[model samples]
Target: MMTVIGGVDADRLLKDRHRAMWALGDYPALAAEVIAGLGPALVDAVGVHPGEHVLDVAAGSGNAAVPAALAGGRVVAADLTPALLEAGRRVAADRGVAVDWQEADAEALPFADGAFDVVMSCVGVMFAPHHATAAAELVRVARPGGRVGLLSWTPGGFIGQMFATMKPYAPPPPPGAQPPPLWGDEDHVRGLLGDAVTDVRVERRTLTVDAFATPEAFRDYFASHYGPTIAVRGAVSGEPERAAALDADLVDLARRADRGPVGGPTVLDWEYLLVTARVAGGSTA
Candidate 1:
């Protein structure tokens, strides 16, 4: 199960790490609270119709999948982390919606080609180690004339800036790896889709998270539940001062970025890229 990309065997060396990172905390809980409303928004944007075969790739906790199912599409929720897929199953069950949950890698989906009428990912897929491979897989599994929708963090957005804040302390990405934020770029997204699709459209949107009372609270929550923050904390655990400094810097970032009134609940605005495209005819595998 070795997927070679950029001269590196990512399946052997990176996929496990990616899975472990996401498995660290209850991402479902965090995602439910922080990304509330985004799922439905994406579903609506994609115009998921009843009886359509929908696949939500890298579908963390069934966010988009549940909504798609609710909209009457036959949904399949797929992710690399089993725990996340399980969480998605629970969500589907609770909502009285049926979704086929699959533990599958975004870079290499387990489904057949041209299997779905609509393929969607919300704040997912971009994290895949091999961006090009992941993108191709997305296009590959979608039927010709089908639609693909994705929501990704823009490089200049707040969340992207937060990652930048932690970059100095965190190890650099794998050699030759494309940064996830590139998915946010309209031009880059066009390049990734290439001639596989048409009627490609990219729109910028903002999502607001109002879970914490202050910037410090926001920082604490992320440090505890967000995978990247948790990893960064562990990476600097042996160096107490470094960890503290990193925490302080993150708090400052939250404070400066907060758009809410001072002393009010922290309402952070995150800008993202929303992409929608129709798979071109004759591109089906």
Candidate 2:
């Protein structure tokens, strides 16, 4: 039986499942090692200044939030998964940076309008079920002239292809559900934020992840640590042959994209889009 919460659309129940999926594996452990460097880079790109109020939506393990706090901004790290939030708290504490952590939903942020000087999400908000609602919330929470920054995987990127590879094994998304990779498209982003902000800019960048000696080893690590991969693993668990075929396909894809064997370790280059925009009526500087 399907259940709806807070008068949300039936399809929106996927949010609950999404939450569960992320909670399965140790995302913080994996994210800390995988995308840690991108956090500070994104914070810098957003121009977070000292004394400004910064909100890191879907802040996994305080990656961007801790860096913002270190940059002298008052930071609030929010996410739907409590485990990830707890992990973020630990990270902030360990880094000796003060960050206010909150459990939050991106689509309908638990924040007042014009509440923050800067809002950001790094590979985070794109996962929200309702893209438009999430984009609006990101804009709505920013003060006029405030900046908003985001990073998302482009449809043509390695990560996007990886997602496509898992489609055969994973359950299909709800009908009409927007693809998360669409957030990486400049035109799609313009459509989403056009009315809310100005000076919108999008840039393509590459993020590299450490890979194991062989594609099979890399696939095993992702299958064990990554949320989506884990979900797919479970979905095909009962069917051994199907699971093997899916694994084989993913390994082949990895081999095709490999950019390693460079002495020490191999790496996979994942292309992502960086978006920066200013709330309408704000200083264009």
lDDT of 1 at 31: 81
Worst window of 10 by summed lDDT in candidate 2: 1-10
lDDT of 1 by residue, 24-118 (tens): 86689888888868889889998999999999999989889999999999999999899898888888889999999998989889989999999
How does each model score on TM-score? 0.94, 0.93
Compare the candidates by lDDT and give the number of the best one: 1
Question: Residue by residue across 112-194, what tens digits does model 2's lDDT show?
Answer: 99999999999899888778889999999999999999988898998889888888788878865687888888898889998
TM-score of 1: 0.94
**Model 1: lDDT to the true structure:** 0.88
Residue 47 miss distance in model 2 (angstroms): 0.8
Which residue pairs clash in candidate 2? 145-282
- The most accurate candidate by TM-score is 1
